[model samples]
Structure formats: structure tokens, C-alpha cells
Target: MCNQARFLAGAIFSLGLVVSGCSSVPYDGTSGMTDSNVRTSIYSTLDSTALVYTNPAAGAPADDNPWRWAGFVMHPIGVGLDYVVNRPLYSISSTFPRATGYTNEDAMLDAYRQR
Candidate 1:
């Protein structure tokens, strides 16, 4: 009836708002070192998972065994989490200078340079 129709309209409007809020823009970790795009974001996420799981860093016990398979299994889940949760959170926080933890580009660059 009328109530059902109104509920459906409200649901659709809410879905549209949620979808619009999600951004595909790749996070610029290095202040324009690379292009920002959906593809870059996906690649970076996957690459990070691969690097962490495949290369265990110096003197970390080279097992070279079954643990590596976990990375393959987790990569998709990690990517999904990044896209669904992390990216949207970053997008929202990046809008506010205080939220981003840097007042300006100079401060950000200095912090990175020191690291």
C-alpha cells in the first residue's frame, strides 16, 4: 500500500547516498608520486599483501613452506576490506585537514622526508 511504496523509495534514496559517498580515488601516499585511479588502488593493495606474505624480510626464518598459501587466500579478502572500509574511511577523513593529521603539504612532506 502507500506505506510500502514510501519505504521502498526511502531505501532506494539511502542506497544512492551510500554509493555516492564511496570514492574510487587512489590514496596518494607520497604526495603525487604516482597517479590516482581505481586501478592503482587495487594494484597497490594487492602488491602490499603480496610483499608482506611472499617476502618475509631479512633474517626472519626462511621457512619457504605452507604459510605462503595464506597470502593467496587472504589477498582477496584484504583487497575487499581495503576497498570497502579503508578507502572510504580515508576519503572521508582526507576532506578534513585535522582528520588527515597534517595541516599542509609542507608538513606532510617534511614528515615523510624525516622518515
Candidate 2:
């Protein structure tokens, strides 16, 4: 077929270029990848999820961090309207104890609620 001949010609040309030391990429490009590396990296990361979880700084922190808190605070505030809004279960139980004279959270909330 015509397409087959063109494919063979391209393959032979590539081989010839490599043999003659004519093939190359610029310094800015990847040393191994002929196209993009991101698609490959995405697939590779999905394939190796354990590699991400074991690392603390793997994009998202599993533990409490102020950065994490700030990001979710807005979304939770929005969604929370559903759960606590005008519901019989919604007692005005203070989410945080009143500002304790001490800076401790437990003591503050406890003191706030007059518990």
C-alpha cells in the first residue's frame, strides 16, 4: 500500500539519521522523551499511588495544616448550610468553647459553653 511504503521510508530515514549521528534534541527538551512527559508522568503517578502517600509533601497533606484548613474552610462553610440550617437538630451548641482566659482550645470552648 502507498501508506505502508511511506511508513517504511520514514522508518528507514529515521534509522539512517540515527546511524549518521544526525538525530538530536535541543538542550531545553527532554533527554528521553520524543513528545511530552506530563502525560507519561500522570499515568506513571496513577500507577504508583503508594509513592505519593508515603511522601508527606505529595501535593496534599493528610494531616492538619493551616494551608489545608484554609482551602477547605470556604467549601465546608457553604455545604454546612445544608446540615445546620433551620433544622431541629441544630442546637446552638457552640462549635468552639468561649475564649477561655487561657489560650488553650479545650479550656476556651469549655469555658465559653459555661460547662
Candidate 3:
């Protein structure tokens, strides 16, 4: 009976994941549907473009570690899961008023301008 219950729970969880994963709406930065709304950190254009090219082409030696290969396989899956779970929550939270300080874009741009 316990085994049957566990299987049923797992099936339900899988179904939820499948249903939630079908979001077709593109993330255009703003939390709200309008451009006037400030962009939230949940999905940042800056973050998606945050990759740094520290080395020249063919400059760095590849690691021979097995775990490095495992990470290479898993990184995209983890990032996708993080986005699927957090994006809606962030959008919901953004509808509420913030307590203080500038929005994320303003703060980051201001810091960059200072430098």
C-alpha cells in the first residue's frame, strides 16, 4: 500500500512539472506586461550575458577530471530548473511595491557609471 501511494505521489509531481514547464511567454525583462514596469532580477538580460571570456582562443588547457564532465552535462539542466521555478514567483513579487532604494537596473547602471 505504501509503495502504491509513493508511486501515485511521484506521478502527480511529474505531471505538475510537465504542466508548469510549458510556458511559451518570452521574458522581455519587465515583471509586468508593460515596458514601464521595472525589470526584476528573476530573469536578467545582464545575467544571461554575464559569461566572461578570460582566455584567448585555444589558450586554456582542458581539465581531465571526470567530475568536470559531469558538471558540464548538468549545468544547463540546473539553470533551466532554476528559471522555471523562480520566474513566476519573481513576477508575482514584483507586482508589490518595494520598500526602498532604486530598481535593479538603476542600481547596476549607476554603479557602472561611477566606475
Candidate 4:
């Protein structure tokens, strides 16, 4: 019974991974930003870890803000998550043809600016 349960769980997880790769949208930054596709959603979620280290006020001088302190405290954690979890997943996903997501930060930023 225990073995059967483990097999069933593995099967379900594998199915989820396979189903997630079915997106027809290309990962050209802009298309992924607009398209409601699984690959883009996953990439966006992972990439959002960058926010913790980024300044809350864009193009402005750093001020004595509490949010800046919070960001300071969280910066190391965000960096670790980006390097360990996010980048690794992005690297793995990019290996599969037609499964490439937003691996380029510059492209993603350009897309966001265009929007």
C-alpha cells in the first residue's frame, strides 16, 4: 500500500510537469509577459525574487524609508533564492526546446518598460 501511494504521487507530479510544458507561446519576453501561459507564469513567480533586493522607489535617490531597511534585511535571502532556486529552475527549463522562459533579466525589464 505504501509503495502504491508513492507511485501514485510520483505519477501525479510527473503529469503536472509534463502538462506545464504544453505552452505554445514563445519566450520572447514580450509575448510571455502578455500571454496567460504556464511557462511564463512560473518564470514570473521565480523572477519576482529580485524585488526584495531592488529599490522600492525607481530612479530616485535612496531615502530614510522603512521599506529600504526591510529590503536590506531581505536582500541576502532574495539573492540566495535567486541564485539557488530561481536560476537553477530557469536553467533546467531552458534546456528543453520550446520550453524556454524569461532567463534574460534585460529582456524582461525591456518588456516591462514597453508595457
Candidate 5:
């Protein structure tokens, strides 16, 4: 059934991550994996990290919210790449709404600087 497609999709997504270096920023400030940049990287990183830690099996989904799986699955490797490729002044968390929502885009931008 359709469930298989999602599993396949998750596999493909993970494969894409590995094949494309699913790591971090480009020298020109973009995701070497896709068209993503530090902005996308941070947002995706925090977003995914939240989901996977919150729930790992979901990170390799087979349902309507499959997109939720993307960031979570990518975080482990992506975060490593983030630390390696960038300065990593500090890491923000999802503790306070004063900064922003579930995504860390605003804080990442506010605190963003190159390594």
C-alpha cells in the first residue's frame, strides 16, 4: 500500500543525505547537500533534532507527515557537519518562545556568524 512509498521515501531521503554530503554550509553559504544555507541549516537542524529526539521511529516515517522525518533524520550528520564546518559559537534550544517558535531561524539569524 501507500505505506511502502513513505518508507521508500525515507530511505531515499536518507540516501540523498549521504550521497550529497548531507552535512553543512557551502563556502558561499549554502547547503552542499541541497540549495540550503546556514539559515536552512539551522532551522532544519533544530527542527529535525527536536523531532528525532522527541520521536525517532517517526524520523523514518510512513505516513502523511513524512516531511517531518526529513530534518530529524538529517540532524545527526548535519549537526556534526555544522560543528566541523562552522564556528559554532553557541547552540540555542527550544526552551523559550521569547526567541521564536519550534524552528530556530530567528535566533540563528540573530546569533549567526561565520566560522
Candidate 6:
């Protein structure tokens, strides 16, 4: 009975870690996230700037057997989870802004002008 209790607790903890690990939303340090227009504009601009430059398919020329097998197992799981879980979360998150003021453009243009 004690072993069973320990196993149950461990299982619950593992599940919590997995869920919490993936569950995060973008946040910039500002308050008053009540304005819909500001949220929409900020979300749009941030989306444009946050480009995925790294090619997902690009990796080391050779991986060992374990890595190859791990990737084989995890890649499809990631895609499936992304479609079922991440896509909807992303859509919902886009409705909120990452920053309350000063977008990426503002910072970049200002730096350019200074230089």
C-alpha cells in the first residue's frame, strides 16, 4: 500500500511537470492588460518580429543510435501535440499583447537612428 501511494504521487508529479513545462504564455513587464486594440496591435507586431530562423530539419551530420531513436519517437509526438494543444493556445494567446508599450520596431528604429 505504501509503495502504491509513492507510485501514485510520483505519477502525479511527473504529469504536473510535463503539463507545466509546456504551459507558458509570452509576457512583457508591464501592467494594465485591459485594452483590446493595444493587445491586438502588439500581438501582430510581435508575431512578425518573432521569426523562426532556425531550420527544424537542420541538425548534426551524424547522431548516435539513441538520439536517432529518441528523435524518431519524439518528433511525431511533438507534431501531434502542437496541432492538438499548441495551435489553439497560440491562437488564444494572440488575442493578448506581449507588451503594453514600445514594440520591436520602436526599439530597432530608435537604435538605428542613434547609430
lDDT of 1 at 87: 96
> Number of the top candidate by TM-score?
1
lDDT of 5 by residue, 17-113 (tens): 8777745644554435552221222235436567555645444424436665787798898879878765343344344455546455765876776
Off by over 4 Å in 2: 22-115
lDDT of 2 by residue, 2-111 (tens): 99999999999999976766346345535566533322222233346666556534534234368776777788786777677844234443443343234477667878
- For model 3, how big is the CA root-mean-square deviation? 24.9
| Model 1: per-residue Cα lDDT over 1-115, one tens digit each | 9999999999999999878754566665675464432122223353556655564343243344477678878999999999999998888887775867757786779889999
RMSD of candidate 2 to the truth, in angstroms, is 19.0
Over 4 Å off, model 6? 1-63, 98-115
On TM-score, the stronger of 2 and 5 is 5
Tell me which residue pairs clash in candidate 5. 31-36, 48-71, 48-72
The per-candidate count of clashes, in order, stands at 0, 2, 0, 0, 3, 0
Ranking by lDDT: 1, 4, 6, 3, 5, 2
Rank by TM-score (best first) = 1, 3, 4, 6, 5, 2
**lDDT for model 5:** 0.59
Supply candidate 4's per-residue lDDT for 63. 51
Task: Give the distance in Å from residue 59's predicted Cα in candidate 1 to where it truly belongs.
Answer: 17
Q: How close to the true structure is residue 34 of candidate 3, measured as C-alpha lDDT?
A: 67
- Give RMSD to native, each candidate: 22.6, 19.0, 24.9, 24.4, 23.1, 27.1
TM-score of candidate 1 against the unseen true structure: 0.35
- Among residues 3 or more apart in sequence or in different chains, the pairs in candidate 4 whose N, CA or C atoms overlap within 3 Å are none
| Count of backbone collisions in candidate 4 | 0
Q: Identify the superior model by lDDT, candidate 1 or candidate 3.
A: 1
Give the local distance difference test score of model 4: 0.68
54, model 4: CA deviation in Å?
Answer: 18
Error of 1 at 89 (Å): 1.3
Model 2 residue 100 lDDT score = 23
Computed on alpha carbons, the lDDT of every model, listed in order, comes to: 0.68, 0.57, 0.64, 0.68, 0.59, 0.65
